[model samples]
Target: MKIHIIGGGNLGSAIAVGLAKNAKGNNITVTRRNIGFIQHLTEYGIVVSQSNTEGISEADLIILAVKPHQVDAVMAEILPHITNKIIASVLSGITLEYLNKKVDGTNTVLRLMPNIAAQFGASATCISARTADLPKANVVTELFNKIGTAVIIDEKLMDAGTVLGACGTAFALRYIRASMQAGIEIGFDAKTALAIAAQTALGATEMLLNQQVHPEQLIDKVTTPQGCTIAGLNEMEHQGFSSSLIKGIKVSLQNIKSE
Candidate 1:
């Protein structure tokens, strides 16, 4: 598949890296105002350009990774050239309806929500489009699956998915940082503390993934009555760990909705 990614910023670069790594023989183009920073992508057979119209004109799939506010300008630049190809927008809070209006409803539009983990081929991406666009949507779903897990969801849930999957990456990292800090306070050096916290987090996540069990089930297994594990868990809860996480996700969704 020929793919053009507009905006070679962080998320766009990550997506290009993941796709280039996993999907050989596919022609990929990444566009930005300054192409020098992402010129290295050419080593993987990906093209780097500063022209949005040129990128859009050359690809079968156009992935818009531009800022939400820049979408209008990009659309205006490319609208005259776009044909019936599928267009996927990674911009947060940009609706399919808005895109369709901008393009005069000629193209099949999709909304994709993926995190920075895309660079590691481990993103949890959400795909959404109108019911009539399912055929093209599935093509996108398969494209994203090359980099990570992809789920088809109602457009209404895109904001919630952004919170839990995109912002959730940062939340998980913050928890690891906190754990590492505590480990350091207990005498471990910074590197060892980071290793311990990161590996522990990976193990915990693997357990949940492989076992297909509720988190509380694993918690019960780890926490015997009056055990240190139980004590620490309770302390975290008391300090509003879970509550704060839930509140944070809610706020993120609210902010997206407001936008």
Candidate 2:
């Protein structure tokens, strides 16, 4: 796959590096108005350019990772160069319908919601495309799975996926930060507190993934009769922990919809 990624910002550059490191045999080019920022990608054999259309004409997959407001301008610059290429967008709030409209319905447009963790090959990417484009979508999914997990979902849910899969990274980190703070108050050093909190969160996630069981089942295992775990959990619940996170997610979805 010859991949050309436009807008070499954080998310775009992360995807470029992730793909370059994990998916071999694919030529990748990343573009930014100021290549100085992402020039380091060359070490991974990725071509870094300042022009969005530099390799777009030859790209099999053109990834749009620009800001939502910049999509039109970027699309205008490269639209003439695109043929039947697969255009995958990682921009939040940009829908497939809008992408199809931009490309004049000439290309296979896919909306992908992936977080910054893509750079470390740990992103949970959600992909959506037209039903008729499932085969191409699956191919893209396979490519992304090399960097992290990728799941195909209905386009209608793409915004929700953005909230959970993309913005959720921040939410998870905030939880870890809170845990670290608690750990510090409990007598651990800052570094040690962070390590414990981060590792504990990772372990919890791994268990859920490996066991494929309900989170409450694992909670039951940890929350023995009148245990500290249950006590803390109850306190957090009483303070609206889950409710706040749920409301935050809903607000994020609403913000995207409003845009």
Candidate-wise lDDT, in order: 0.91, 0.91
Model 2 global lDDT (CA atoms, 0 to 1) = 0.91
List clash counts for every candidate, in order: 0, 0
Q: Estimate the TM-score for candidate 1.
A: 0.95
**Winning candidate number (TM-score):** 2
Clashing pairs in 2: none
Instruction: State candidate 2's TM-score.
Output: 0.95
- Could you give candidate 2's per-residue lDDT for residues 1-259 as a string of tens digits? 8999998999999998899888889999999888899979999999999888876878899889888899999888888877899999988877788888888877889988888888988889999999998999999999999998999999889889989999899999999999999999999999999999999999999999999999999999998898898898999999999999999999999998987
RMSD of 2: 1.3
Q: Which residue ranges in model 1 land beyond 4 Å of their true spot?
A: none
The regions of model 2 sitting more than 4 angstroms off are none
Query: RMSD of each candidate?
Result: 1.5, 1.3
